[model samples]
Target chain A: MAEECYTELEQAIQVLVANFYKYVSKHSLVRNKISKSSFRKMLQKELNHMLTDTGNRKAADKLIQNLDANHDGRISFDEYWTLIDCPYMVYPATDLCK
Target chain B: MAEECYTELEQAIQVLVANFYKYVSKHSLVRNKISKSSFRKMLQKELNHMLTDTGNRKAADKLIQNLDANHDGRISFDEYWTLIDCPYMVYPATDLCK
Candidate 1:
C-alpha cells in the first residue's frame, strides 16, 4: 500500500479521507468529526467547483442538514461520503469526468 | 472546472467517480451500474492495494453483500460509495492515509 504502489483510484480515495481529517476538530469531545462550520468551509473550499451553491449560505446549510443523518450537528466520514455520492454534485461537474 | 483548475482534493473525488464508470458493464440491461462480476473485477483491479481480501471470493462476496444496501443485483454509484466509506477497508490501508 505504499504511495508509489497505489493505483490512481486508491490515491483518490486517500485524498478524500485525508481531506476529512484535515478539517476535523482536534479539541472537540468527539474526535475525528468535522464541525458544522468546518463542514461549510469544506464545501466552499474543497467543493466549490462541483457544488455551485457552496458559496450560498442557505444552500450549504441545507446540504449540511441533509448530510448530518444522525442529527449530530457534525459531519462524520460516512456522512461526508454521502455528500460525495450525491449525483447532483457529480453529474454537473463534467470537467471532473473528463 | 477545467482539469487544470481542479484542486488536489477535487481531482481525487473525480478519480473515484470515474473509476466507477470504468468498470460499469456496457452491455448490462441496467446501464451505468457495475454487475456482480464487474464489481469483483473492480475490487481486484482498482482496490487490490486497499482491500487485502479482494482475491478471496467468499470475502469479496460478503463485502459485496454488505455494500449492496438495497439488495439490487447491480452496484450503483451510491452503493459503490458505501464500500468506500467502510472503515475496515480504509483504516487498515495505512499508506492511503499517508
Candidate 2:
C-alpha cells in the first residue's frame, strides 16, 4: 500500500514498531529481546531528549527494575512499550509529545 | 524546545500521545476515558485502513471487549495503547506501520 494511504495514527504506530526492531537488530545475542545493557544504551542514545538522567547508570537500572515485569533483566517488546508510555500515561497534561 | 531536538522515537511517542487527546477531547462527558461508542468511531475513522472489518460493528465491539482490561466497558488510555499495539506486538513482521 502507498504511504499516503495510512492515517496519522497508523504512521505513528509504524514508527514505534520500526524503532523496536532498529534497536533490537543492533545486537545479535539478544535476538528478540533487548538485554539490560542494550536497553541502557537505547535509553542513552534514543531516549535522552525525552527522558532525564540517561547519563546515570543507577537511574537507568532503577527504571528497568520498574518496567521489567518478569524480572529477567531483559526488555521484551511489551516491556519496552510500557516503559515509553510511562510519561504519557502518568501525566497526560505534561506529556513530552506535545 | 525545538521539534528538531526530539529523536524519531520521541517524536513517535508524541504522535501517539497527541492522537489520544485528539480523540478524547472530542467528548466532554467521557473525561479521561474513551467511551465505547467513541472508541468504535475512532477505530472506524482512524484505523479502518490498518484494521479489517472496521465497518462491522461486531468486530469493533469485540475489539473493545478484548482491550477493556478493567472490564468497565470503556477504553482507558492504557487500554487504547494496548489495542493499537496488538497488531505490532502480535505480528512484528507484518506490522501495519511498515
Candidate 3:
C-alpha cells in the first residue's frame, strides 16, 4: 500500500513536469513568464523553505528539491527547464553528493 | 517538426493528469477542493467555454475536454478520478461515437 502511494506521488511529479514542458515548447513566450536561471533559484529557495517546517514545508520543499539535479548549493531556471523534457525519477542521497 | 510539436502536447497532457492523480491519492482532501461530479461537470462546461473563443477558449476548453472521457454530454466527478491511475491516450473520434 505504501509503495502504491509513493507511485502516485511520483506520477504526479512527472505529470506536472511533462505538462509544463509541453507548454514550454509550444509557447516559447511562456519562457517570458519566468527566466530559466530564476526558476532554478526559486526551486532551491523553496527547498530550504520546506526544511523550515513552519508551513507546508515538506510538500513545498520536496516540490523544489525534487527538481534540483545537483545540490551544488544552487540551480538556475535554465537548467530547470531542461529537466521538464526528461523523464526524471528522484535522485538518491549519494547521487546528490556528485 | 510538427510531429515533435504534437508529442510535446501529448506529454503535457499526461503530466498534468499524473500530477493530479498523485496529489489526489496522497492528500485525499484535495478531492474536497471540488467534488468528483462537480469536476466532471465543470470540465464539460469548460469545454463548451472553449468553443466560444471569447477568452483563451481553446487552451481552457482543451484542458477540460481532455479530462472528460465520455461525451454523454456530461461527466460526473467519480468517473474522472479513476483515470488518474490509468495512463490515458486521447480517445479517437470513432471511439467517442460510442
Against the hidden true structure, what lDDT does model 1 obtain?
0.80
Worst 10 residues of 1 chain B by lDDT: B89-98
Residue pairs with colliding backbones in model 3 are A12-B19, A15-B15, A36-A77, A36-A78, A37-A77, A37-A78, A40-A77, B36-B77, B37-B77
Clashing pairs in 2: A14-B97
Q: Write the per-residue lDDT of candidate 3 for residues A1-98, one digit (tens) a residue.
A: 13243233343434444444433333354442333344444334322221222134354335446555655323333334433333331211111112
Ranking 1 against 3 by DockQ, winner: 1
In candidate 3 chain A, where is summed lDDT lowest over 10 consecutive residues? Answer: A89-98
lDDT (tens digit, per residue) of candidate 3 on B1-98: 13243233333434444443432333354442343444444334332221223134354344346555664423333334433322321211111111
Name the runs in model 2 displaced over 4 angstroms: A25-29, A88-98, B25-29, B88-98
**lDDT, model 1, position B58:** 76
TM-score of the candidate numbered 1? 0.88
Chain B TM-score in each of the candidates = 0.87, 0.79, 0.25
Residues A1-98, candidate 2, lDDT per residue (tens digit)?
Answer: 67788887777788887777767736667677887787889887887777766777887788888888999888888888898677643342232222
Off by over 4 Å in 1: A93-98, B93-98
Highest lDDT: which candidate?
A: 1
